[model samples]
Target: MPASSHHYRRTVLLLWLAAAVLLGLTWWHVFALVSQSRAKELANAERDLANLTRVSQEHANRTFRGADQVIRFIQSRYLELGNTLDLKALTLQGVIDAEIFPQVGVIDAMGIYTLSNQPITGKLDLSDREHFKVHVTSTSDALFVSQPVLGRATGKWSIQLTRRINRPNGDFAGVVVVSVDPGYFTRFYKELRLGQRGMMALYGLDGVARALNVGSREEFGRQANNSPVFARIAAGEEEGHYTARSVVDNVDQMVHFRKLPGYSLMIAAGLDTQSVLGNHNAAKEALWLQAAIVSMLVLALATALTRHLRQIGTEMNTRQRAQRQIEERNAQLNAIFDLSPDGFVSFDNKKRVNYISPAFRQMTGMGNETLEGVDENDFSIWLAWRCATSTPFLGVAALRADLAGGKPDPRVLIELNQRGKRVLQLGLRSSKSSSVSQILYLRDVTHEAEVDQMKSEFLATAAHELRTPMASILGYAEVLLNEEFNAATQHEFLNTIYVQSKLMANILNELLDLARIEARRDRDFRYTRVDLQMLVTDLAHTYPVPAGRSGLELTLPEQPLYLMADSGKLRQTLLNVISNAFKYSPHGDPVELKAWIKSTPNRAPGVCIEITDHGIGMSPAQLARVGERFYRADTSGKIPGTGLGMSIVKEIVALHHGTIEIDSAPGLGTTVRLCLPTYATLQDSVDQDGPSRSKLDHAIQDTRPAALS
Candidate 1:
């Protein structure tokens, strides 16, 4: 009986030891996982802060750079035109972005506020201002960024960006000052949606804040020399991040900062530590709860080991089921990866390709190639070869080197010369799983790139078109301001200014009209039955026939050709077509305007208005791009036209459920056919498909105007 008791005591002792060991190991695992998760969370927050800092730095740089450009331009103009620079006219002409720099002025050598975009009520002395004093003391051509101060001219808080104006003889003439609104930066930061406790700031290297936002509170001109960032900057670091207590609010934050290139300013973004780690704390709590439950289970198992040794079998079965569930979950994840539109690739811990999703294979056009087990170097080379030859992957070596150093840019853009031209945004990230060390994601961004490119081109074209007339107006006005002339000469100059002003107004009006039409489509149109014959006759009678050009030869069908359209818009379209006809033709060339009823198979009956012009006809290439905005065949600048008339005409015609066809050849006459749905046919369509459907069909059909040579 004693021996039995000893053995039982030994068994219990052994069970207790096993339970203690299990509990200890389980808790260790939980702590380790929690620590790792905390580190990852902090790391991700730092990365996000870094990205935001970079963006903010870029924004600040652009703002300062643009301000510098404006200052330099004004400085040059002030020196060239002296006091006759006319800042008000420049502002009106959009040479100055008035909304951004509300007060742009010139302070003369004697400290007098000589000129400004804003009206100067009386002589204002600006010599005592830091921006003015700095330029007055030094002849440095570098742009000076000053601390936030109340502008005497603007009557508001602004940052003064100044440049020295030098005369032709190298004398300091004055300072050109541009007042930038500090609220601009803060307004943009608000859009970033940083956490409630987040912060974004712009500080000069000299330790003064240009603009700073902490939570919802904003401060300017606050000294920050005591901040840790200055110490790092003193150590020659251009950019860095760290976790520290804020000097302003005493809140601990994960802060990332970047120094704006070619400027003395730096931008910093911070995420509140508490806010960033809130989720991590929650996860840790759940893990600890799980650990507690596991410990209780271990103790219970130790206590019941003798009576329920069979419980071990049940535990094994449960583990098996759990393993099966894990496998099924993995399969589901695999299916999701397969069906995802974005491409993904995983690299094993050894930096060799382990798996590539089907989408990745198809995206890279390497579906047939065996890529598994390929090392990073070989994979980079293969990928580089697939990229466009014109823009070869020159960064492959650098990217590989960065990866080897365990740091790489998070994102890159690669253009591929594959099935068709494609632009893919590639993102790299570390994987959490033990088997996979890294993950690469690829997303198609061709459409976005194209859109950005088109927008840039449109802005550039519009600017160029507007600048020409502006230059003329500014030049003539400057002449009038700077020099005295005879009555005839003055009248000629005034007339030139008037003509250029009219041209600018015309361009602006047309641009607004085009924008309105594109945005609202036909929603703003007041539709009604309109007489096409009457519209044509009225247009020809009131049309301003250019010098050496005859009136339009108008013809109409016996029956009044009617259209279900906006009469005003229809009249504008006809006028634009007729104007273009006269503008492009030779002397005495008659613009033939003919109207008749027309019908095509499988289409509604319509009225066709044909306008024929016989001089300087376009080539097939030019004709193909006739309706494109700002596309003028006459690049020699001899022609006086905005090149938007045809575009407007096409838009108006399409809105009226019509089609435009252009037939032309180089050195030959051109015929433009505008076919509009007749009132009856439109009424029938409205009865059958509803007005909206009919409009949709018309829009789809008229998306591209037909051109023939």
Candidate 2:
């Protein structure tokens, strides 16, 4: 659609056309070179065939001329010796050369055969022999060469060459025959080293092979009348060449043949076309295949380049669209940072500020100027002007030492105070995606510090509580041992010692119980369905107290008031609270214990138990630490009890997911209210049931507020 894209596509098209043209030219050159090489190979093959033919012709001419000279000498001797001549004696004188001619004989006018090398014991008939009959019938004086025939005398296959023996009056005398082994010619031709299917043959004019060797086969006495090469020779083709399959061996060959001048014989030498031109054809095909593969690879690379160009153009359009929407996303991110409660600050690998949220600016007096050239040491000072001395890191020096590491721990806790008033805890952690980047978070932890201070005071108060009881026990025992008093006074002294010892035991037991309850890790309080009315009734009747003092006053709801809690722990908590009411109250002072089903604001519907005492009520400062472990309101060494009863009671109540509210005054009495979760809030937490008073829309119900005994 655009000018740049259109021009880009046109350029790609031209490149592809150029590649195709080059490939075509490559193939043309390959074919031209193959054709020229093939022409030279054929010319070389023709030269080899011609040389073989010339060699075979020379061998045949020489062999036959020697045979003719030998035959003439034998004929003259036969004419001289007549019937009285001893052919055996002539052969014995080494005249015949038996290695060349195995059997030499003479056939008489009656067609009887005889051997010159050995004595003929029996008469041998040879009338049917081609050698004998050719001489008898022929009128020419030339020597006749016949096809291979089995000798009646020697009983072996041999080439029979014979000449006529005529009388002085011109009557037929007999035949002088030379029996030559066909192996001589066949073995000589086999050594020509022609290709796998080359044909080397010697044949007579009568269209029959005298000796033949084609590839490794040797044949004798076979007709060659149907051969195209032989037909051409018979038609006066004395020396020529042609490409044709041999009729004898049926192989395609290039043949070079010639006829002997003084004899009716032909020599043919040929080489198979498959052997001579095979390498040429293979080289041509390999060149074509290699060129084709290279061309295809070039085309593929060009096509890939074209596609890559198109993709780049498309990507450019997409990049423009993405740029337009970046502003909108930036606004959304700013709004998110503004609304976040916790402060956030991020820094990159170079310790340079990348992003700073509005909350981070509000927590630290920093602005956009803090974004550049701010390292971890500067960030640490920005984290806090001051840090608690109790923690591992205190100042910017410690923070920078930790930051300069190959790999540092991800999370760090920074404690600081804002304007020397409010405390803040900052969490610094590595970003999840990278180790070289970090995120910082800020939260308030002022209330947590106050709780730690209260815990420290509790440990000091526990030591004082134990020492007071042990001092009283040791003082009374020392007074009785050093002075002699009345028996009644001595018994009173023993009673005081026993009472102080019991107080010490109660403090130790309460401390162990509180520690065990708080040490649990989870909501591990075992809960069961409890009938509140029956539980209070049993406690009122079973509690063992002193005989003359004012005991516990029980006020219970009429209904069941079922709850979910650890029953043993709940009973211990109630017992400890009620016992404290009686212990702090003087004799005849009212100690009332009340139970009811009620719901308070910001709490679920539950059963609440209250214990009231009119004895020495606590001040405001004392009530705040009343439930702290081993803390006491009376610190003047007068109270005869451990200071840990209320602490144990508070822990048991908290484990049941409940609350304890203490209301007290300096001169007035004190009332402790303990509220436990009922079945409505704890049905899934534990197995429990409460009374079904669904329509009692008021807060407190079934309160049984009666006068105490």
Candidate 3:
């Protein structure tokens, strides 16, 4: 057998041995606990039974003695008046109570008749009564208590108590009897609350139950001569306990009995065994339940250990397989990390560099030098030098303060010149899952920042443009209100006011159009088919040319070239281009418009329109920004043109999936080109790059577009 299998068997045996030992100990504990519980319960029950017995006897003594005392008082009256006793008058005067003693009378020697507390209607004799027979047999001073019997006078079941009545010669005369209701003793005992199936019984010296209250019933005429419980008390036992069933109710119980000290009566209290030991049994059952639960937990732990041991070999094999796969992929990940375009670097909470990307190296001009030992202070020195050598808009001190300040903006943009003009956006992000606390990144945003600057300049230029026209309108209106002029001069001033007011209104309307189209949230354009030949011919004929300045020339293809576009916006775009051509050209130069259909590689067949002006044109620098909002080539307030016209033209062409081109120089002229797709579906004009390119190109291509110039 293999050593591994032998080891497995040994380990399994050890686990089971441990479990068996633990189970044995648990069972021992449970048995000891249960035994202790049983002993305590028995001791408590015996003590409680003794207390109950004492209480029952005291209750029986007080009631019986009270009745005996009443009988003695009645006997004194009988001895006084011999045969002519007025028992009815004594009872009527509240001297003798019929409720306590239902019948108090005396029997003659012949046992023929009797005198009672209440008058008897019929002939009631007492010669056969147990109390009368006892006195005739023994002429003693002791009271004879008999078992419950129906009274001859009252006809109610009662315990008969009699004392001997002797004549002057000391012979047996008769018996003075008292009928004691047994309910008083039984009801008193019932209040003692001996638990379920309890009893309080009174037994005579003759071993007969005189007054008994057993399980809620009162009865008599029962003999206890053969009872083991009674035999104990009869054989000179003072007090004792035994387990037996009641003779009156037959309920199984533990009976506790005590003989009255000076009387021949014995009172016993019995309680069901279940009531006495039920709590102890419950504690034993709870111990058993705990043992069962511990056993289940042990078995479950064993099963888990076995399963874990079996999986060890498989897990080892899996770990080796995963290690090889990680090794194979490590090189590819490193290559990507070095080549990423965005600069990346990490720093710990103490400002130690954890990692630095190659792009970050190039940006900081640390050519081919390893950054492994570089700390944040080293990078800070490099950053300080870069800020000094480059643009100083926000100085090195300001940038350094933010880096070391209590708190700083997470992202900050800096305008600088490195290899070329550049805008570096620096940002910090937290990394929680490493020793490194922060990662700092830098991205080149030169083109975006320059465009943003141009927009800002454009906004200022627009405000100036709007205010210039308002100033003219307000000047002419104030002059007209105050100064008197000839009819022709006033008319000229009014014309100037009208033209300036119209210029302001047109600028405001154009700004509104730009805002609506750029929103892109809803349908911005109503698409329709347009005929280029008709559009160009109409624009040429009704051209807004100055009277003695220029000619509007049209060069259109004879065949109608139709394109799918928003006609209203397209018309506005074309008119803006034409108007700018006339507005910017030298006073007598001709503004020419031409249109034709042209097709390009990977693009749909589209209409091309070129507006060329033979005027003093823009420099290369000015031409670059000609398509910006509110940008103007002429800033001297000489040319009658708002810079927004070309930008609007560019936006409208781009919306129709078209492009704009401008070719110009410092002193020559400028030509604007628009190449638009013809009436085909919008998707036909879209360009999708195939897989025949670098992966980076597919992800984020930096392409510079030129219109058909």
How much lDDT does each candidate structure score?
A: 0.79, 0.71, 0.71
Residue 62 alpha-carbon offset, candidate 1, angstroms: 13
Please report the candidate that would top lDDT against the real structure: 1
Clashes of each: 0, 0, 0
Using TM-score as the yardstick, the better of models 1 and 2 is 1
Give the top-scoring candidate (TM-score): 1
TM-score of every candidate:
0.46, 0.41, 0.41
For model 3, residues 1-709, the per-residue Cα lDDT tens digits are 9999999999989988987876676677668767876776666677777877777777666656766776676676567567777667667777667766667777878775567776777777778877788788886858778888877667778888888888777887777777888876777777877755777788887788877777677777678777787668657789898887666666677888899876788887777777777887886787687677767766778554334433433553574476445321000000001222799788776667778888878776667867555677676565655653545434323444665674333457665445656677777655566587667788877666666676678668778889999999999999999999999999999999988977887677677666666656226776655657777777777776787875678888555566666777878888898777777775678888888778666755667899998777889889877877778888887777666787778777777778888888765677889887654322342235322224323332222122332
Q: Candidate 3: where are CA atoms >4 Å away?
A: 88-98, 302-709
| RMSD of model 3 against the true structure | 50.6
Candidate 1 residue spans exceeding 4 A from truth: 1-388, 391-402, 405-407, 410-412, 416-421, 430-438, 596-598, 604-606, 654-657, 678-709
lDDT of 1 by residue, 419-526 (tens): 898888787766557899887788877777776787889889989999999999999999999999999999999999989988887787788788888877888887
The candidate with the higher TM-score, 1 or 3, is 1
